[model samples]
Target: MTVVSSVKDLEALTLTIVNEFDAGVDRVWQLWEDPRQLERWWGPPTWPATFTDFDFTVGGEARYHMTGPEGEKAHGWWRFLAIGRPASLEIEDGFADANGEPDLSQPSGRMRVSVEDLGGGRTRMTIASHNDTVEQLQELIEMGMEEGMKEALGQIDAMLAE
Candidate 1:
């Protein structure tokens, strides 16, 4: 088990934001590491997600395909850099085309997730995403990534609170 007694304070860099969810650290970690659980809460409410090849471990890889409301398909992958059990996770994440090949022109990012158990059955999950540049951050903003994450995490809260 990862020691989540310490809270991590992160500076907001290019497109960095911290979201706190009121759930146990272990519960939050389960929502993160389990592909089925992620698919339940990780996509837009209009479009359901289906995941393939998900392995949550250091050096492991995951691939996900989400069908948009307009019937368009989006794919992505993450190369896990670190997996701190129920406490933290770090990974290099990127988007790919339908065939599962990297699109170099798309912005890639490094994401670090710190799970701090706040006791009383709550956990503050902070996500720090480092993009290549400010331009990349702006691009992601234009792509509605922030709102998407917010909505997904909101769904996570709803699901976990059950």
Candidate 2:
């Protein structure tokens, strides 16, 4: 129940998910800093993610796969563009091929993750996904990106609780 709200702005070609956690910024930031913690909530409940490789530097790359209930796997990769540490991160996120290489045939997006200290051991986290074009945004939406993101983010509360 960490998610406060989710908004999809078609006109701006962005999808933003806002969440609040009853933990300090540094503690909440571990959700991204630690790959194991990330794997626990990076995907929807029905599709659990496993990070095969992770590097958190500004120019680092993270490769992962989400396995569906039916045993199907969806590959993804994130190339970090900026890392502000316990506060914000920006990356180019894209679908990947079986070999974990970026699949240009699939639309990619820029994702910005921001963590704000709400004080009193509380933190506000925001994930903003920006697509390059209207068509690309529509395509992601058609793929249930909104719902998937919501479900994925909803798992964060349990992680924080742990």
User: What lDDT score belongs to each candidate, Candidate 1 first?
Assistant: 0.73, 0.84
Model 1, 91-142: lDDT tens per residue?
Answer: 8877777797766788788988888888898778777777766675664443
Could you give the C-alpha RMSD of every candidate to the true structure, in order shown?
A: 9.2, 8.5
In the range 83-148, model 2's lDDT, one tens digit per residue, is: 999899998988788787878887789989999999999999999999878776664443334446
Which is the leading candidate under lDDT?
Answer: 2
- Over 4 Å off in model 1, which ranges? 1-13, 104-107, 133-162
Error of 2 at 69 (Å): 1.7
Could you estimate the TM-score for every candidate? 0.71, 0.79
Residue 85 local lDDT, model 2: 91
| Index of the highest-TM-score prediction | 2
